[model samples]
Target chain A: MGRAILLDKVNIPGIRAFEVYREHGGYKPAGKALLGMTPAQVQQEVIKSGLRGRGGAGFPTGLKWSFLDRKSDKPRYLVCNADESEPGTFKDRYLMEKLPHLLIEGLILSSYALGVKTCYIYIRGEFKYLVGILETAIHEAKKNNYLGEKILGTDFSLEIYVHPGAGAYICGEETALLESLEGKRGNPRIKPPFPAYKGLYDCPTVVNNVETLATVTSIISMGGDAYSKLGIGKSTGTKLMSACGNINKPGVYEIEMGLPVEDFIYSEEYCGGIKNDRMLKAVIPGGSSVPILPADLILNTAKGQPRLLTYESLAEGEFISGSMLGSGGFIVFDENACIVRNTWNLTRFYRHESCGQCSPCREGTGWMEKILYRIEHGQGRMSDIDLLVRIAKNIEGNTICPLGDAAAWPVASAIRHFRKEFEEHIK
Target chain B: MLKVTIDNILIEVEEGTTILQAARMIGGKVVPPAMCYYTSLKGSGGKCRSCLVKVAKGSAKDPRPIPKLVASCSTPVQDGMVVENTISAEVQEARKGVVEFLLINHPLDCPVCDQAGECDLQDLSYGFGMEETNTREPRREYPVVDIGPLIKLHMNRCIHCYRCVLAAEQLTKKRAHGMLYRGDTIEISTFIRTAIDSDFSGNMIDVCPVGALTDRSFRFKSRVWFLNPMDAHRECSHCSGKVAAWMFGNEIYRITGRKDTFGELEEFICNECRFEKKDISDWVIEGPRKIKRQSVISGNHYEQMKKGSIIHPIEGTTEPQE
Candidate 1:
């Protein structure tokens, strides 16, 4: 509802056009960079700002740009990871569905900065409708001379294509997404030959997440320094928190990164408090894959300090204890919700999504899901709880991608945080 | 290399190695029951729950706890580490539960399956299954599904092990199969029935630990124990990812995934290799036709007709003899 850099004029009557964006001092950064600054200088400015990826990982955006294998004579490529298929994450969907131009403008600037001639937005298959919306936006951008071949009379040329995924969740993983882009299966490739080093038909590439690329537009516009002042140390800027489940307002909201968790949960200014004034049973601060935190532990850090929403504060006392800030998929559990059922839901997702590439994840997730389902359905024994823990432990670090970890973490955390609820559900 | 011990047995393995991988390096070094494990899966997929072993703690009075099993499938090796694989009542109980759970819908129709000779469930059941059915009622039957044109389904026999789905996803770089439900109600289904078809379809039959997913081409042909396996990397009918086919009575009856230079079979097979296997297996060579010559059936009427049918009147076309 508020104005973040990306959504500044999204709801306005006349602001959805290039002319309107242009009037509001948009595309000036690209023009400035093209007309005045060099690509290297633009990268240096981004690096100086210390902006991190808005996608799940929170990787340093400037550092990601810096990792481009510049030594190659081959063309450099940029891929936008629009496959935002994580269960609780929907920020990118809102941004793309509402204000497609912001992403396109950011993409153009990013393309110019990285010397990328071709950019591809690899969106998840579920976003099939959005693909046409984005295509129309791309067509509109091209008509206005911002997308194809030499933007605003600059010698640099670029073309953007929208490629749809076939409903595989693993495509959200960067390496897997790259492989899919090359018309291969959506399995994650091994690291070291990471997409940054070698990717997209085996060329030098930079694959930035969708929200990560959208942030680039504002960085160039308001200047990275101004953007940096919005949040706390390192985790600067406004993060799009996708709050759902139990909250009165269950939707995507732009909030400063350092907002207090207590305030976010109870304040009228934010989610308008938990539903029906029910006692908050728990909160999955980041996304579903992160550990679930009990209400009290969520209110206080491990050292018994106030829990703020900065990545550092939220991440304090992690590892089988605290919750994760992954992908910003916040799920809230009120008293009415069943912890075992909710956990079963998340485990079911991981079990379903597991590519089965590795033995542990492929088999473990399925096994765990079945066990959790049993527990929730009143078919579990006393020992099933311990078995759930053991199964999750086996899957934690033993897979091709974080999807395994993503699947295992929630089960482990849910068990760790709500063992009583699980016991209660057990018949 | 980091030196480690399983029970009292000492072994050395590389750094960044899981206890499972270390055990794999030294034959019988430390037997961690790994159902779904390999070093390549980026160390995850801990499905089988069989590789449980005990580790050393600091006390002598009670050096070993009551439990003596840890899933060696994913635990990495460390210097001076110690582990024990003795069967504890708890480990056995856990193993039993997991086995019984996996067997809920598994059609133990081993006598009719092509994977019977080399099945993990059959092999692991002795050590894991208690010979007592957890459920008192009749075993469940999962409805058989037609996943694709090439691969056949025996969902009843499937233990719900997802090895095949992963193999197809990894090799094809496309997610062809996915587990659709959650918990005991969870079933493996494609997002839609339209087409789970892919080149890597045969690999599902390969990684399935039981008869849950049997090949339609070789469905009623022979039991797996009768087939002799030859490890020749036969070029896939379409892409690389050399598929290993089982030969029974001089006929290649079944195709399973083998470890390859690429990712796992399910995930790594090219679409062409995955889908075109059935056509390749069913190939027939046409004999040379002689327009002027005929078969040596020099008899009247019926014999002449048989000879005439054998030879084509047209030199290059397959036409009836005049």
Candidate 2:
């Protein structure tokens, strides 16, 4: 597998400043794209490359760019979602701390591709230290002519601002990030007027996750086809996965898409063969939002094929059995980790972060959490197990946004995939 | 102009409608229940199972899609889709099952609940609850909290409908509320503290599906049924926006986002709107009918306006100007 592009040299020497970065071909892509191509041409190249968002939505990056409300007279804004609040999803944090410039470079180029002049890096408020890291890098870039007014005599100018969240998890949702950036509450605005249309003070805006935007500089440098060649099928290109829990290397690891789940977890090089050499009980392939797969199911699919870790293969069935590659928050559990209790914890997070928006999610998430809390505390009844599943099913696909679905995924899938664990916990 | 029969009653409604919305078009009750449907928001927030109704496999004339009960809030009504919202014992049982599940963990704390007389869960339990719980397990406990300086919480009464959270996120133009925990252990909290001090924080207490998210201002003030609901729209003196203010005993206690308008987003009424009703420092005094002007802009302004009046102008002052 190819080493992560931005992460590869993150710890390497000569990767900090533009002098060091430029000495090792750092601004080559931005320079080449700026000097050699039009913004439309750059977007077309990415679209042609078939690169999808690494933010777990797996939405085509080029399409997302193309969807911008182009005719709008309002100023276009590029918002980089630095709010990495999803549990088990820590890859964005690593990128911000280690490879800030990589992200900054990506933001500039992606901004250019969208023809944006002012961009906002909506950092999660809890990343108090990261805000400074990003600020320092922006200052370094401004001093070196990377982010400020103009660069290398190009006809474009951009101003990047790092806006920190007030620590709400829903702020990660693109629209919610826009609301937070505008100094409004961090709740998501309604769609159809998706952020691409009217966002951040009612302007045409594009909100891309940190990893999703960082991939653009590579796509521009290598051309779309070369970047697309790194991965397989509709899910093209490499993804930076934060493979934590029960793994020998519980750190951020970038792997080519379509790598088998067993190989990613059990390989001596990757997760380093599940901790203590225990059996793999389940793997939350995407993040906490994706449904867990049993060791057998993780190794093979419903058709008896090995479960390939691509967007399609992992979420082929629907339900958590089939789920959105939601934010790449992969939490691993060994045979001993109770799927029920872990699900209860995740539900507790959703119930907590529910933003209380929509009835089913607010009431439904809280209801599911309470019942599961009871079951986990050892006062579980047979009916309580059924009640947990019932409440989750009720809240699924029925809210103002996907937060309700996010809340329901673990509960519905935990029961679907690990009904036995729930039954066992019922005393 | 699509036509469909609901429970053998033929009705005509616009095409591209949900059965619940279609049922509502005829001006009576639809047997299926909905929690997320704020009919003012076009009635489609299908997060609750109470709105489940069985639909037929094919034409409206034939009914044979067994177990095809779908949430009416989210499900769109098709031309030939047959709906059996109340025909079968099965539909009623499913509704009862859902209501019972909703109540199992619900705190029977309605006696002290501010929303006791008008809560949807209270009404639903009356209509469909079948659970007779003997389990002595204590109800979920949450310390009464001041979530926002304006919004008070008896989280124990929260059904977690998320209406308040959604309103805060989407309607109130702020992400003031969210779930704090996951699964049965999950709860609604302000992440760090319970206080939602946003100017829009008062909206949560109204959007709360249950008494869990209650208003500090209206808490234990009066039963909802005791207060006569007046259908009057008052202009927001602070802004051009009009708020639907509810008056209890000739005094306006609360105001909310009025959805009973044409082509307007459910604009959240801020604390200024909800609390401004009772903060009336002055009122116009009328003697049958008379014109008078009294100004307190400056100490002598009241006298200046009254200098030309036939009757001496009367003005009460809370503060004196220089």
Candidate 3:
């Protein structure tokens, strides 16, 4: 329904092959960036594009790149975050599986723009099959002069490597991924000396999401201003949303930023409305980390405004009545779905994924899971509801990383929107 | 210098000083309890959420307060920053919740635990925890693993502070044991059946906040309250010989690294200083009068220590010469 950018040539036959991909305008932008644009000029265009990170946090890509300590003589590095372990989020995996060359082309261009000599794609361990696919794509790209030393006959040389994680969901976190990249345990580092200043091997580094890097190709292809103009406001360009649960068409869909939530869900071209014509109960518009919104809230805001898929629109009410467009992992639930059970499932995921670093996340997630499990299994007291809220409040914002907040938001939002369901489960 | 008002008391500290350090510097009613932070170890902060504090105003460098409560142990104080520890009801409640969660899986076998007198978790729970536990669900249980002849790991009591892990890697540059599983079922275990035979292996007992890792030599030898501790040192080729000798009557039972008033190790003693140097003749032991305060043991032990009930060595025997 929207102008397709990432998925346009994704379904084309032999797109995974470098020859077919180069024939269909794959490495042209990378060639242009390497030959024509200065690294600073490329960074400036990215700043002008206003492309926010597709990696849940929505940080501006150019702003993140600008923070790199350029004066430091340490070798700079670029890490493409392919650890797509977020629940209901498989868009990156699909992008790599189908259009691996696009990601490679984007990685080369990004590496050149950042003045990085080496780049690593830290993919999730469960995506072991994609590692082979990506390695093959890398070999093909290098053979075609799209990657490796002296790419496109330019002075800029970059070597991209595929590093696999040991199936830890916490590795999806950027700092934890960096730690894992160094062959250490996947524990997140503290901020202030952020990754830009001191990252891989204590050097200046930039870690971009797979989708975020892939979009760089388009930004360079059509000038940044043109790409910025495609989407509304600060949320520029197209986004790949992986839709699942109770939907007839449950797959990744790339749409322009300001698509209305209603059309995206009910329209035949998108999710094709709820399955079997059942009433929508709730929707986690983002990944599991963001707040879950009720059907009414997901459709429109508390201010009676139509909720758009853009970052600003979806997050209009903040945590009170609004949810974020985090990772663009859209999950839907029909009226038959139980919020308590759903919340329990998500809490269990978070508890399992917690790296056991921070006390609030490490201990609180386990407590919440056990409590939610007890309540769902009909052995909870009425006080357990208040206790759950109290525990979630204590956990949010108290840990070393966002994992604490990630573990807390779903439980709190579930209780906020579906209190009656939880209450009923208690009786 | 950065001026911060913690609990309405203004204090100035050097830049890049964390709120926990500032609170400790001021030394009043506002000292935040941290379980995982070891001042000597790099990258030791941020793991434990027990030191959560409210910052009303942020520093000049970072103008906005973090959206949520920040760990005082990791958050550096900015110029003109305002922080609240015990004064904030929210922070108190949050700390209480953290203490509760920590105790959820803790076997609470303090009666049998050897580290009862000096355990940081026991002290923190008494200071910040509620009277009763709300969860009726079964607590997590783990089979205790004897790490070696030096340390016994009762993982169920562990809060997963990572101090021992950091001590192993940072102090010894070797890892014998690491976190094995994920999430609630997580446990610290050695890779194979190999013993943690590093020279710094015994320091794991000192770094553990709970009774998870106990000294095998000192196990059931004597209650900590009954032992009289004296600061002692010896000329050794391995490392700094500064240590604390815990004596039962005139016989030395165990030796550990000496700790300052803040309960931080003055120096991370080696296994030789910790285990092999248990004899009284190994080093010159100081007088027992230096033992001013002991970590709280039970209900009445604090009162007993306050009344100076510790037995001093008789006359000239204090100078034990090799």
DockQ of 2: 0.11
lDDT of 3 at B74: 87
Q: Point out where model 1 deviates above 4 Å.
A: A1-3, A190-192, B1-322
Q: Can you list each candidate's DockQ?
A: 0.06, 0.11, 0.68
Write candidate 1's Cα lDDT for B1-322 as tens digits.
7777766667877777766666666654245555555343342344555565555632234444423344566555667777655534454555555565556446566666666655667767765665654332345456667777666776656555456666666656577777665334456777775456654456566556666666666767876544433333434445544544444433555555553221233333444433344333342212211111221111212122322232232352233435
Greater-lDDT candidate between 1 and 3? 3
Winner by lDDT between candidate 3 and candidate 2: 3
For each predicted model, how many residue pairs clash, with residues at least 3 apart or on different chains? 47, 51, 0
User: In model 2, where do residues sit more than 4 Å from their true spots?
Assistant: A320-324, B1-26, B30-322
Error of 2 at A104 (Å): 0.8
List where candidate 3 sits over 4 angstroms from the true fold.
B277-283, B289-322
- The order of the candidates by DockQ, greatest first, is 3, 2, 1
Candidate 3 per-residue lDDT, tens place, A138-217, comes to 99988888777887788888899999998888988888889999998898887767999889999999999999999988
Top model number, lDDT: 3
2 or 3, greater by DockQ:
3
Kindly report, for each predicted structure in the order presented, the TM-score of its chain A compared with the true chain A.
0.96, 0.97, 0.99
True contacts kept of 3: 0.76
Better of 1 and 2 by lDDT: 2
Per residue, candidate 2 scores C-alpha lDDT tens digits across B223-262 of: 6544323333445554434454443434555555443211
